[model samples]
Target: MLKSTMNQNKVQTLKGFRDFLPEAMAVRNYVKNLLIDTFETFGFEPIETPTLEYSSVLMGKYGDEADKLVYSFTDNGDRQIGMRYDLTVPTAKVLAMYSQTIPMPFKRYQIQPVWRAENTQKGRYREVLQCDIDTFGTNSPIADAEILAVINTVLQKLNFKTFTILINSRIVLNNILKACKITEDKNSILQSLDKFSKIGQDGVTKELIGKNIPKAKITVLFKYIKQAQPDEYLQNVINQLKILGVSKNNYQFDPTIVRGLDYYTGPIFETVVTKPK
Candidate 1:
């Protein structure tokens, strides 16, 4: 009997992973319920996908760092597979695979765990839950507006304040990078520039210089990002893109944001919470 008990205790979770107990699960369920209710009220439907996906499907979708972090392995059938890294990529694959079957402009809300073979930090874990709401097959601003409104409503109900929602477009960033003569290989440089808020402008400038980006161009880029309003920034970018023969509407320029994700093709946004520590 003692040996059996010892054997049970010896089994443990891998490092950087965890198992939620009942009390924690109850709280999690409650939060998830609230999020589900909010998303459903906004006409977002629930969908689920497999936890395992073909390794090729998830690779290169979330940038180089994320690609390196994917939990890939060979199954008994000698097929390479990976644990789902984020709800978005799997959802995208589902859309492409069932393009003919699913309804157009599919609005989906998914809550699932994603695995990452990376270091954990505060408010981040190797395996964590992501709540995503997305609309496919529509390029309407109304769709974008609805997503923003729904997210704002959910956060308001949660009593979170002192935060702002920053929105931008990847096209706009790409144009800016082009203006600075920075190649696409400078994704890490751009990512560091995006961190200006968290690490300060001086820190970002130093990091960019370290990355071998020109100091004068970095100064110009930083000044551009600090524009006070979206309208002013849009005007400048619109003028620049016009000279380059790119339409203003196509970029969907919004000055309020710099999204962290590399895969976001159109409008991108981030929520900044300023609750007291």
Candidate 2:
């Protein structure tokens, strides 16, 4: 009955969770070390934040999908709390609470685990670690460029290839969304549509229609997004804005991008792998 006993004693992992053994842990540590070294070389200091934060602190920040995915519950003290969803929000809170002590134009790198209740799939996990380095107090484009450059250099060092960096500003997207006649209440609809790259056009279309967005508008929005290269796309967007007489320096029409979260007030970027995954 040894086999029966072994079967009976087998422990099941929770859904959307995983267990990494020693070799996996070693690989993770190695990668983390490389990231740390790169960030330090660029003069970013390290910072740590707690895993659990009051739910109110993170509320109304990361948009609907992110809000839905956050691991939140009432604690023993009967307080609503959540596991950290991303480094950026926590960083913002830290700055708000400890601004007096921290240096201006603070640059910090945080590597930590974030929890989300998303569907589990390859390269996507409900719980995953993020390697984040952010500079607050300075809205300089130079800081943006530096972050991009550091990411590129580090990824190249790791032998990653055939990747494209997509960058844009949320201000630009807000203008476009208004131009498209999509309501603010439907921002999630746009964000969901942006997932077309990962989930395919048909899947995204289904999601949008499911949200009751009109089929014709969705069709036009997809076509408009697909028409031009990065620079050309920005120019086209500028032309459209000029026609509408809306003047804004921040809303650049960056064609290289597909989608990003709502909380990114300024520059937002993503690196997409062009080669097979």
Would you list the C-alpha lDDT of every candidate in the order shown? Answer: 0.75, 0.73
Most accurate candidate by TM-score = 1
Q: Per-residue lDDT tens digits of candidate 2, residues 125-169?
A: 888898899888874556666676677667766776556556665
- TM-score, cand. 1 vs. native: 0.85
lDDT of 1 by residue, 1-277 (tens): 9879979898777777889999999989988999999999989999999999999999988887779899999999999999999999999899999999999889999999889998877766788898999988986566765676666677777777555555676666766776667773657876786776778878988988888878888887766665533434434433444454432332343443566567876667776677632
Minimal lDDT window, size 10, model 2: 244-253
Error of 2 at 48 (Å): 0.8
Instruction: Point to the candidate with the largest lDDT.
Output: 1
In model 2, the number of clashes is 1
Report residue 160 deviation for candidate 2 (angstroms).
1.2
User: How does model 2 score by TM-score?
Assistant: 0.78
